[model samples]
Target: MLEKVRYEGAYPTREKADEAVRLVLSGLGRQLTGDERVDLAARLPWEAARGLTAQIPDTRQLTGWAFVKDLAARTNASLATTRWDTGSVFAAVAAHAGPDLLTRILHQLPTGYALLFGRAELTQAA
Candidate 1:
Protein backbone atom coordinates (compact mmCIF):
# COMPACT_ATOMS: atom_id res chain seq x y z
CA MET A 1 0.00 0.00 0.00
CA LEU A 2 2.81 2.34 0.92
CA GLU A 3 4.60 1.36 -2.24
CA LYS A 4 1.47 2.10 -4.28
CA VAL A 5 1.14 5.49 -2.64
CA ARG A 6 4.82 6.14 -3.28
CA TYR A 7 4.31 5.42 -6.93
CA GLU A 8 1.22 7.59 -7.03
CA GLY A 9 3.12 10.42 -5.40
CA ALA A 10 6.04 9.88 -7.80
CA TYR A 11 8.43 9.58 -4.91
CA PRO A 12 11.85 8.27 -5.99
CA THR A 13 12.48 5.63 -3.36
CA ARG A 14 10.91 3.43 -0.72
CA GLU A 15 12.86 5.22 2.02
CA LYS A 16 11.38 8.52 0.96
CA ALA A 17 7.93 6.94 0.94
CA ASP A 18 8.53 5.48 4.40
CA GLU A 19 9.65 8.83 5.70
CA ALA A 20 6.54 10.53 4.34
CA VAL A 21 4.29 7.94 5.97
CA ARG A 22 6.18 8.28 9.26
CA LEU A 23 5.99 12.04 9.21
CA VAL A 24 2.26 12.03 8.53
CA LEU A 25 1.58 9.34 11.13
CA SER A 26 3.71 11.08 13.74
CA GLY A 27 1.86 14.32 13.21
CA LEU A 28 -1.47 12.49 13.23
CA GLY A 29 -0.55 10.65 16.42
CA ARG A 30 0.04 13.97 18.13
CA GLN A 31 -3.33 15.30 16.96
CA LEU A 32 -5.44 12.32 18.05
CA THR A 33 -6.54 11.27 21.52
CA GLY A 34 -5.16 7.95 22.81
CA ASP A 35 -8.26 5.96 21.97
CA GLU A 36 -8.66 7.57 18.60
CA ARG A 37 -5.05 6.84 17.85
CA VAL A 38 -5.46 3.24 18.88
CA ASP A 39 -8.58 2.89 16.79
CA LEU A 40 -6.81 4.33 13.79
CA ALA A 41 -3.83 2.09 14.35
CA ALA A 42 -6.01 -0.96 14.56
CA ARG A 43 -7.43 -0.13 11.16
CA LEU A 44 -4.04 0.30 9.53
CA PRO A 45 -1.66 -2.31 8.18
CA TRP A 46 0.76 -3.74 10.77
CA GLU A 47 3.77 -1.62 9.88
CA ALA A 48 1.67 1.50 9.55
CA ALA A 49 -0.13 0.62 12.77
CA ARG A 50 3.20 0.25 14.57
CA GLY A 51 4.25 3.65 13.27
CA LEU A 52 1.03 5.19 14.57
CA THR A 53 1.31 3.50 17.98
CA ALA A 54 4.97 4.22 18.62
CA GLN A 55 5.81 5.97 21.86
CA ILE A 56 5.49 9.70 21.50
CA PRO A 57 4.72 12.84 23.42
CA ASP A 58 1.20 13.73 24.48
CA THR A 59 -1.33 14.79 21.87
CA ARG A 60 -3.07 18.10 21.46
CA GLN A 61 -5.76 18.98 19.00
CA LEU A 62 -4.46 21.09 16.15
CA THR A 63 -6.10 22.81 13.22
CA GLY A 64 -5.38 21.56 9.71
CA TRP A 65 -2.81 24.27 8.99
CA ALA A 66 -1.01 23.43 12.17
CA PHE A 67 -1.03 19.80 11.18
CA VAL A 68 0.67 20.61 7.88
CA LYS A 69 3.12 22.97 9.54
CA ASP A 70 4.06 20.37 12.12
CA LEU A 71 4.68 17.78 9.44
CA ALA A 72 6.79 20.20 7.39
CA ALA A 73 8.93 21.03 10.40
CA ARG A 74 9.39 17.40 11.35
CA THR A 75 10.26 16.23 7.85
CA ASN A 76 12.16 19.38 6.87
CA ALA A 77 10.11 19.49 3.73
CA SER A 78 8.61 22.65 2.28
CA LEU A 79 4.94 23.25 3.08
CA ALA A 80 3.97 22.64 -0.55
CA THR A 81 5.77 19.33 -0.54
CA THR A 82 4.29 18.49 2.81
CA ARG A 83 0.81 18.98 1.39
CA TRP A 84 1.52 16.61 -1.47
CA ASP A 85 3.16 14.12 0.82
CA THR A 86 0.23 14.28 3.20
CA GLY A 87 -2.25 13.68 0.40
CA SER A 88 -0.29 10.69 -0.81
CA VAL A 89 0.04 9.13 2.61
CA PHE A 90 -3.57 9.77 3.47
CA ALA A 91 -4.82 8.33 0.21
CA ALA A 92 -3.17 5.10 1.26
CA VAL A 93 -4.73 5.40 4.70
CA ALA A 94 -8.19 6.01 3.31
CA ALA A 95 -7.85 3.01 1.04
CA HIS A 96 -6.74 0.70 3.84
CA ALA A 97 -8.78 1.98 6.77
CA GLY A 98 -11.96 2.35 4.68
CA PRO A 99 -14.74 4.94 4.79
CA ASP A 100 -16.29 4.35 8.19
CA LEU A 101 -13.05 4.85 10.10
CA LEU A 102 -12.12 7.71 7.83
CA THR A 103 -15.39 9.47 8.56
CA ARG A 104 -14.82 9.02 12.27
CA ILE A 105 -11.36 10.46 11.95
CA LEU A 106 -12.69 13.45 10.02
CA HIS A 107 -15.22 14.09 12.74
CA GLN A 108 -12.47 13.97 15.34
CA LEU A 109 -10.42 16.55 13.50
CA PRO A 110 -11.13 20.18 12.71
CA THR A 111 -13.04 20.90 9.50
CA GLY A 112 -10.25 21.61 7.06
CA TYR A 113 -8.58 18.26 7.57
CA ALA A 114 -11.07 16.50 5.33
CA LEU A 115 -9.35 17.86 2.24
CA LEU A 116 -6.11 16.18 3.21
CA PHE A 117 -7.93 12.91 3.42
CA GLY A 118 -9.35 13.51 -0.09
CA ARG A 119 -12.86 14.13 1.09
CA ALA A 120 -15.23 16.59 -0.49
CA GLU A 121 -14.90 20.22 0.50
CA LEU A 122 -16.68 20.99 3.72
CA THR A 123 -19.16 23.84 3.76
CA GLN A 124 -19.31 26.23 6.69
CA ALA A 125 -22.30 24.39 8.04
CA ALA A 126 -20.43 21.05 7.89
Candidate 2:
Protein backbone atom coordinates (compact mmCIF):
# COMPACT_ATOMS: atom_id res chain seq x y z
CA MET A 1 0.00 0.00 0.00
CA LEU A 2 1.50 3.27 -1.10
CA GLU A 3 0.63 6.12 1.22
CA LYS A 4 0.83 9.65 -0.01
CA VAL A 5 3.76 11.56 1.45
CA ARG A 6 4.17 15.13 0.34
CA TYR A 7 7.28 16.42 -1.38
CA GLU A 8 7.68 19.55 0.68
CA GLY A 9 9.87 21.47 -1.72
CA ALA A 10 13.34 21.78 -0.13
CA TYR A 11 13.71 20.20 3.28
CA PRO A 12 13.68 22.89 5.96
CA THR A 13 14.61 20.43 8.68
CA ARG A 14 17.39 17.89 9.07
CA GLU A 15 14.70 15.44 10.05
CA LYS A 16 13.24 15.79 6.59
CA ALA A 17 16.64 15.48 4.98
CA ASP A 18 17.44 12.55 7.20
CA GLU A 19 14.19 10.85 6.35
CA ALA A 20 14.83 11.44 2.68
CA VAL A 21 18.37 10.12 2.97
CA ARG A 22 17.25 7.15 4.97
CA LEU A 23 14.68 6.41 2.35
CA VAL A 24 17.25 6.67 -0.42
CA LEU A 25 19.84 4.68 1.48
CA SER A 26 17.32 2.01 2.20
CA GLY A 27 16.21 2.18 -1.38
CA LEU A 28 19.75 1.82 -2.60
CA GLY A 29 20.13 -1.19 -0.30
CA ARG A 30 22.43 0.90 1.84
CA GLN A 31 25.00 -0.75 -0.44
CA LEU A 32 27.48 0.96 1.77
CA THR A 33 28.80 -0.81 4.84
CA GLY A 34 27.81 0.38 8.30
CA ASP A 35 30.82 2.68 8.47
CA GLU A 36 30.20 3.97 4.97
CA ARG A 37 26.54 4.43 5.70
CA VAL A 38 27.40 6.24 8.89
CA ASP A 39 29.66 8.58 7.04
CA LEU A 40 27.06 9.35 4.43
CA ALA A 41 24.33 9.53 7.03
CA ALA A 42 26.09 12.08 9.20
CA ARG A 43 24.69 15.58 9.27
CA LEU A 44 25.91 17.70 6.40
CA PRO A 45 24.78 20.49 4.11
CA TRP A 46 22.55 19.89 1.09
CA GLU A 47 25.34 20.88 -1.31
CA ALA A 48 27.49 18.21 0.30
CA ALA A 49 24.92 15.53 -0.50
CA ARG A 50 25.07 16.68 -4.10
CA GLY A 51 28.82 16.19 -4.20
CA LEU A 52 28.57 12.86 -2.46
CA THR A 53 25.77 11.63 -4.70
CA ALA A 54 27.74 12.58 -7.76
CA GLN A 55 30.52 10.43 -6.43
CA ILE A 56 28.28 7.41 -6.00
CA PRO A 57 28.32 4.98 -8.93
CA ASP A 58 25.25 3.94 -10.92
CA THR A 59 24.15 7.38 -9.81
CA ARG A 60 25.35 8.65 -13.13
CA GLN A 61 22.86 6.19 -14.58
CA LEU A 62 20.16 7.70 -12.39
CA THR A 63 18.13 10.10 -14.43
CA GLY A 64 17.05 12.15 -11.44
CA TRP A 65 16.06 15.33 -13.23
CA ALA A 66 14.08 13.46 -15.85
CA PHE A 67 12.34 11.33 -13.27
CA VAL A 68 11.29 14.37 -11.25
CA LYS A 69 10.14 16.18 -14.33
CA ASP A 70 7.99 13.17 -15.14
CA LEU A 71 6.77 12.85 -11.59
CA ALA A 72 5.83 16.51 -11.43
CA ALA A 73 3.81 16.09 -14.56
CA ARG A 74 1.94 13.20 -13.01
CA THR A 75 1.34 14.95 -9.70
CA ASN A 76 0.02 18.30 -8.53
CA ALA A 77 3.51 19.40 -7.66
CA SER A 78 4.81 21.38 -10.57
CA LEU A 79 8.48 20.71 -10.04
CA ALA A 80 9.55 21.95 -13.43
CA THR A 81 13.15 22.63 -12.61
CA THR A 82 15.08 19.42 -12.03
CA ARG A 83 17.48 19.67 -9.14
CA TRP A 84 20.39 17.33 -9.95
CA ASP A 85 21.14 16.05 -6.50
CA THR A 86 20.60 12.84 -4.51
CA GLY A 87 18.25 14.47 -2.00
CA SER A 88 16.17 15.89 -4.82
CA VAL A 89 15.97 12.42 -6.35
CA PHE A 90 15.04 10.98 -3.00
CA ALA A 91 12.43 13.65 -2.52
CA ALA A 92 11.02 12.76 -5.88
CA VAL A 93 9.99 9.33 -4.63
CA ALA A 94 9.51 10.08 -0.95
CA ALA A 95 5.84 10.61 -1.60
CA HIS A 96 5.42 7.10 -2.93
CA ALA A 97 6.85 3.73 -1.84
CA GLY A 98 10.51 4.63 -1.53
CA PRO A 99 11.41 3.75 2.03
CA ASP A 100 9.27 0.67 1.77
CA LEU A 101 10.89 -0.57 -1.42
CA LEU A 102 14.47 -0.83 -0.29
CA THR A 103 14.86 -4.47 -1.15
CA ARG A 104 13.75 -4.02 -4.68
CA ILE A 105 15.97 -0.99 -5.19
CA LEU A 106 18.98 -2.77 -3.78
CA HIS A 107 18.79 -5.42 -6.45
CA GLN A 108 18.07 -2.92 -9.19
CA LEU A 109 20.37 0.01 -8.42
CA PRO A 110 23.75 -1.61 -8.14
CA THR A 111 25.33 -2.20 -11.50
CA GLY A 112 28.62 -2.50 -9.69
CA TYR A 113 28.31 -1.52 -6.06
CA ALA A 114 32.06 -1.74 -5.53
CA LEU A 115 32.61 0.93 -8.14
CA LEU A 116 30.58 3.35 -6.06
CA PHE A 117 31.51 2.31 -2.54
CA GLY A 118 35.21 2.12 -3.34
CA ARG A 119 35.43 5.60 -4.83
CA ALA A 120 37.52 8.08 -2.83
CA GLU A 121 34.97 10.80 -3.47
CA LEU A 122 32.22 8.81 -1.78
CA THR A 123 34.43 7.38 0.95
CA GLN A 124 36.26 10.61 1.70
CA ALA A 125 33.97 12.56 3.98
CA ALA A 126 34.19 16.25 4.54
Candidate 3:
Protein backbone atom coordinates (compact mmCIF):
# COMPACT_ATOMS: atom_id res chain seq x y z
CA MET A 1 0.00 0.00 0.00
CA LEU A 2 2.80 2.38 0.85
CA GLU A 3 4.49 1.42 -2.40
CA LYS A 4 1.33 2.27 -4.33
CA VAL A 5 1.03 5.58 -2.53
CA ARG A 6 4.73 6.36 -2.98
CA TYR A 7 4.65 5.68 -6.70
CA GLU A 8 1.25 7.27 -7.33
CA GLY A 9 2.04 10.36 -5.30
CA ALA A 10 5.63 10.58 -6.57
CA TYR A 11 6.75 11.14 -3.04
CA PRO A 12 10.45 11.39 -2.23
CA THR A 13 10.37 8.38 0.09
CA ARG A 14 8.17 5.77 1.68
CA GLU A 15 8.16 7.82 4.87
CA LYS A 16 6.67 10.81 3.08
CA ALA A 17 4.03 8.68 1.45
CA ASP A 18 3.27 7.09 4.81
CA GLU A 19 2.80 10.49 6.36
CA ALA A 20 0.42 11.59 3.63
CA VAL A 21 -1.52 8.36 3.94
CA ARG A 22 -1.88 8.70 7.69
CA LEU A 23 -2.96 12.33 7.55
CA VAL A 24 -5.61 11.82 4.91
CA LEU A 25 -6.96 8.59 6.38
CA SER A 26 -7.10 10.08 9.86
CA GLY A 27 -9.11 12.96 8.50
CA LEU A 28 -11.45 10.58 6.71
CA GLY A 29 -11.82 8.45 9.86
CA ARG A 30 -13.07 11.53 11.59
CA GLN A 31 -15.58 12.26 8.85
CA LEU A 32 -16.96 8.88 7.80
CA THR A 33 -19.46 7.01 9.97
CA GLY A 34 -21.88 4.06 10.11
CA ASP A 35 -21.66 1.23 7.60
CA GLU A 36 -19.47 3.12 5.18
CA ARG A 37 -16.85 3.67 7.86
CA VAL A 38 -16.87 0.13 9.18
CA ASP A 39 -16.98 -1.40 5.73
CA LEU A 40 -14.15 0.69 4.44
CA ALA A 41 -12.03 -0.03 7.48
CA ALA A 42 -12.50 -3.74 6.96
CA ARG A 43 -11.54 -3.42 3.30
CA LEU A 44 -8.32 -1.50 3.87
CA PRO A 45 -5.08 -3.17 5.00
CA TRP A 46 -4.36 -3.10 8.73
CA GLU A 47 -2.29 0.10 8.89
CA ALA A 48 -4.61 2.04 6.66
CA ALA A 49 -7.57 0.71 8.58
CA ARG A 50 -6.05 1.83 11.84
CA GLY A 51 -5.40 5.30 10.49
CA LEU A 52 -9.00 5.41 9.31
CA THR A 53 -10.56 4.03 12.48
CA ALA A 54 -8.50 5.71 15.18
CA GLN A 55 -10.46 8.93 15.19
CA ILE A 56 -13.69 9.47 17.05
CA PRO A 57 -16.29 10.02 14.38
CA ASP A 58 -17.35 13.58 13.84
CA THR A 59 -21.07 13.96 14.50
CA ARG A 60 -21.55 16.47 11.70
CA GLN A 61 -20.78 15.57 8.14
CA LEU A 62 -18.87 17.95 5.95
CA THR A 63 -19.33 18.47 2.25
CA GLY A 64 -16.49 17.17 0.10
CA TRP A 65 -15.06 20.65 -0.39
CA ALA A 66 -15.45 21.37 3.27
CA PHE A 67 -13.70 18.11 4.07
CA VAL A 68 -10.70 19.12 2.01
CA LYS A 69 -10.63 22.55 3.60
CA ASP A 70 -10.92 21.11 7.07
CA LEU A 71 -8.12 18.66 6.40
CA ALA A 72 -5.92 21.44 5.13
CA ALA A 73 -6.49 23.43 8.30
CA ARG A 74 -5.75 20.43 10.49
CA THR A 75 -2.56 19.60 8.62
CA ASN A 76 -1.44 23.22 8.28
CA ALA A 77 -0.98 22.68 4.57
CA SER A 78 -2.18 24.74 1.64
CA LEU A 79 -5.47 23.67 0.14
CA ALA A 80 -3.80 22.72 -3.13
CA THR A 81 -1.23 20.57 -1.35
CA THR A 82 -3.85 19.06 0.92
CA ARG A 83 -6.08 18.27 -2.05
CA TRP A 84 -3.18 16.61 -3.79
CA ASP A 85 -2.37 14.58 -0.71
CA THR A 86 -5.99 13.59 -0.27
CA GLY A 87 -6.28 12.42 -3.88
CA SER A 88 -3.04 10.51 -3.59
CA VAL A 89 -4.24 8.64 -0.50
CA PHE A 90 -7.80 8.18 -1.69
CA ALA A 91 -6.73 6.95 -5.11
CA ALA A 92 -4.85 4.11 -3.47
CA VAL A 93 -7.78 3.57 -1.13
CA ALA A 94 -10.19 3.35 -4.06
CA ALA A 95 -8.05 0.68 -5.62
CA HIS A 96 -8.30 -1.38 -2.44
CA ALA A 97 -12.02 -0.62 -2.12
CA GLY A 98 -12.73 -2.05 -5.60
CA PRO A 99 -15.63 -0.89 -7.78
CA ASP A 100 -18.52 -2.21 -5.73
CA LEU A 101 -17.33 -0.78 -2.41
CA LEU A 102 -16.11 2.40 -4.09
CA THR A 103 -19.54 2.99 -5.52
CA ARG A 104 -21.09 2.47 -2.12
CA ILE A 105 -18.54 4.86 -0.56
CA LEU A 106 -19.34 7.56 -3.08
CA HIS A 107 -23.02 7.11 -2.49
CA GLN A 108 -22.49 7.73 1.22
CA LEU A 109 -20.24 10.73 0.77
CA PRO A 110 -21.26 14.14 -0.50
CA THR A 111 -20.30 15.39 -3.97
CA GLY A 112 -16.68 15.68 -5.15
CA TYR A 113 -15.36 12.55 -3.40
CA ALA A 114 -15.47 10.49 -6.59
CA LEU A 115 -12.98 12.83 -8.21
CA LEU A 116 -10.79 12.68 -5.16
CA PHE A 117 -10.75 8.91 -5.49
CA GLY A 118 -9.80 9.38 -9.16
CA ARG A 119 -13.23 8.39 -10.44
CA ALA A 120 -15.63 10.45 -12.51
CA GLU A 121 -18.91 11.01 -10.69
CA LEU A 122 -21.70 10.95 -13.23
CA THR A 123 -25.23 11.73 -12.20
CA GLN A 124 -28.42 10.38 -13.71
CA ALA A 125 -30.75 12.85 -15.37
CA ALA A 126 -34.09 13.15 -13.71
Candidate 4:
Protein backbone atom coordinates (compact mmCIF):
# COMPACT_ATOMS: atom_id res chain seq x y z
CA MET A 1 0.00 0.00 0.00
CA LEU A 2 2.86 2.38 0.75
CA GLU A 3 4.44 1.35 -2.52
CA LYS A 4 1.21 2.06 -4.30
CA VAL A 5 0.97 5.48 -2.62
CA ARG A 6 4.56 6.25 -3.57
CA TYR A 7 4.01 5.25 -7.19
CA GLU A 8 0.63 6.86 -7.56
CA GLY A 9 1.54 10.02 -5.66
CA ALA A 10 4.78 10.37 -7.62
CA TYR A 11 6.71 10.88 -4.43
CA PRO A 12 10.48 10.78 -4.83
CA THR A 13 10.95 8.17 -2.11
CA ARG A 14 9.12 5.81 0.17
CA GLU A 15 9.81 8.00 3.16
CA LYS A 16 8.01 10.91 1.51
CA ALA A 17 5.12 8.68 0.62
CA ASP A 18 5.04 7.35 4.15
CA GLU A 19 5.00 10.85 5.52
CA ALA A 20 2.15 11.81 3.25
CA VAL A 21 0.17 8.74 4.22
CA ARG A 22 0.78 9.32 7.90
CA LEU A 23 -0.21 12.95 7.62
CA VAL A 24 -3.35 12.17 5.74
CA LEU A 25 -4.40 9.32 7.99
CA SER A 26 -3.60 11.18 11.16
CA GLY A 27 -5.50 14.22 10.00
CA LEU A 28 -8.37 12.10 8.75
CA GLY A 29 -8.47 10.18 12.00
CA ARG A 30 -9.00 13.44 13.79
CA GLN A 31 -11.95 14.14 11.55
CA LEU A 32 -13.73 10.82 11.90
CA THR A 33 -15.94 9.68 14.75
CA GLY A 34 -14.85 6.62 16.71
CA ASP A 35 -17.05 4.14 14.91
CA GLU A 36 -16.27 5.57 11.51
CA ARG A 37 -12.57 5.54 12.33
CA VAL A 38 -12.75 1.91 13.38
CA ASP A 39 -14.61 0.95 10.23
CA LEU A 40 -12.08 2.77 8.09
CA ALA A 41 -9.21 1.19 9.96
CA ALA A 42 -10.65 -2.25 9.37
CA ARG A 43 -10.51 -1.63 5.64
CA LEU A 44 -6.90 -0.50 5.48
CA PRO A 45 -3.63 -2.43 5.38
CA TRP A 46 -2.22 -3.22 8.82
CA GLU A 47 0.33 -0.44 9.03
CA ALA A 48 -1.97 2.05 7.44
CA ALA A 49 -4.80 0.92 9.68
CA ARG A 50 -2.60 1.47 12.70
CA GLY A 51 -1.99 5.00 11.58
CA LEU A 52 -5.69 5.56 11.09
CA THR A 53 -6.49 4.20 14.53
CA ALA A 54 -3.69 5.91 16.44
CA GLN A 55 -4.64 8.05 19.41
CA ILE A 56 -4.83 11.68 18.50
CA PRO A 57 -6.96 14.77 19.03
CA ASP A 58 -10.69 14.43 19.43
CA THR A 59 -12.62 13.97 16.22
CA ARG A 60 -14.17 16.97 14.51
CA GLN A 61 -16.36 16.82 11.45
CA LEU A 62 -14.52 19.07 9.03
CA THR A 63 -15.60 20.06 5.58
CA GLY A 64 -13.52 18.97 2.57
CA TRP A 65 -11.50 22.19 2.37
CA ALA A 66 -10.87 22.03 6.09
CA PHE A 67 -9.69 18.46 5.65
CA VAL A 68 -7.10 19.51 3.06
CA LYS A 69 -6.12 22.53 5.08
CA ASP A 70 -5.59 20.43 8.17
CA LEU A 71 -3.54 17.94 6.22
CA ALA A 72 -1.43 20.71 4.72
CA ALA A 73 -0.75 22.10 8.18
CA ARG A 74 0.22 18.68 9.50
CA THR A 75 2.48 17.94 6.55
CA ASN A 76 3.79 21.48 5.95
CA ALA A 77 3.05 20.87 2.31
CA SER A 78 1.34 23.27 -0.09
CA LEU A 79 -2.39 22.83 -0.53
CA ALA A 80 -1.90 21.63 -4.11
CA THR A 81 0.59 18.97 -3.09
CA THR A 82 -1.59 17.98 -0.16
CA ARG A 83 -4.55 17.62 -2.48
CA TRP A 84 -2.58 15.40 -4.84
CA ASP A 85 -1.23 13.35 -1.98
CA THR A 86 -4.72 13.04 -0.55
CA GLY A 87 -6.09 11.80 -3.85
CA SER A 88 -3.27 9.30 -4.17
CA VAL A 89 -3.63 7.96 -0.65
CA PHE A 90 -7.41 7.80 -0.91
CA ALA A 91 -7.24 6.01 -4.24
CA ALA A 92 -5.18 3.30 -2.62
CA VAL A 93 -7.66 3.24 0.26
CA ALA A 94 -10.65 2.92 -2.04
CA ALA A 95 -8.97 0.14 -3.99
CA HIS A 96 -8.34 -1.85 -0.83
CA ALA A 97 -11.63 -1.07 0.92
CA GLY A 98 -13.85 -1.68 -2.17
CA PRO A 99 -16.91 0.22 -3.32
CA ASP A 100 -19.38 -0.55 -0.55
CA LEU A 101 -17.01 0.44 2.21
CA LEU A 102 -15.82 3.42 0.25
CA THR A 103 -19.37 4.59 -0.19
CA ARG A 104 -19.99 4.27 3.50
CA ILE A 105 -16.85 6.26 4.22
CA LEU A 106 -17.81 8.92 1.74
CA HIS A 107 -21.24 9.26 3.24
CA GLN A 108 -19.57 10.08 6.53
CA LEU A 109 -17.65 12.98 5.08
CA PRO A 110 -18.75 16.28 3.57
CA THR A 111 -19.79 16.37 -0.08
CA GLY A 112 -16.57 17.44 -1.78
CA TYR A 113 -14.55 14.71 -0.10
CA ALA A 114 -15.51 12.24 -2.78
CA LEU A 115 -13.20 14.06 -5.19
CA LEU A 116 -10.24 13.33 -2.96
CA PHE A 117 -11.29 9.69 -2.93
CA GLY A 118 -11.02 9.64 -6.74
CA ARG A 119 -14.75 9.75 -7.20
CA ALA A 120 -16.85 12.42 -8.79
CA GLU A 121 -17.64 15.44 -6.66
CA LEU A 122 -20.84 14.92 -4.74
CA THR A 123 -23.70 17.18 -5.73
CA GLN A 124 -25.29 19.46 -3.15
CA ALA A 125 -28.21 17.09 -2.88
CA ALA A 126 -25.92 14.24 -1.95
Q: Give per-candidate clash totals.
A: 0, 0, 0, 0
* Best-first order by lDDT: 3, 4, 1, 2
The better-scoring model by lDDT among 1 and 3 is 3
Query: Which candidate order results from sorting by TM-score in descending order?
Result: 3, 4, 1, 2
RMSD per model, one decimal: 1.9, 13.0, 1.2, 1.9
Question: Candidate 3's residue-wise lDDT over 18-111, tens digit each?
Answer: 9999999998898888888898899899999999999998888787788899999987899998888889999899888889988988888888
Question: Residue 76 error for model 4, in Å?
Answer: 2.5
* lDDT, residue 36, model 1: 63
lDDT of 2 by residue, 1-126 (tens): 011112333556656555444444443432333343334434334543443344344333333344444434533444643222234534334323234343333334434322222222223358
Tens digit of lDDT per residue, candidate 1, span 1-126? 789779878999999998888888877776766466677788888888887777474546778878898888876889999999889998998887788888878888876788998898566655
lDDT value for candidate 1? 0.81
In candidate 4, what are the lDDT values of residues 1-126, reduced to their tens digit?
999999999999999999888888877777666566677788788999988878574645788788898878876779999999888898898888788878877887876788888888766654
Candidate 3, pairs of clashing residues: none
Clashes of 4: 0
Candidate 4 residue-wise lDDT at 9: 95
Question: Which candidate, 2 or 4, has the higher lDDT?
Answer: 4
Give the poorly placed runs of model 1, Cα more than 4 Å off: 55-59, 124-126
**Which candidate leads in lDDT?**
3
Once fitted onto the true fold, the runs of candidate 4 whose alpha carbons sit more than 4 angstroms away are 57-59, 124-126
Considering every candidate listed, which one attains the maximal TM-score? 3
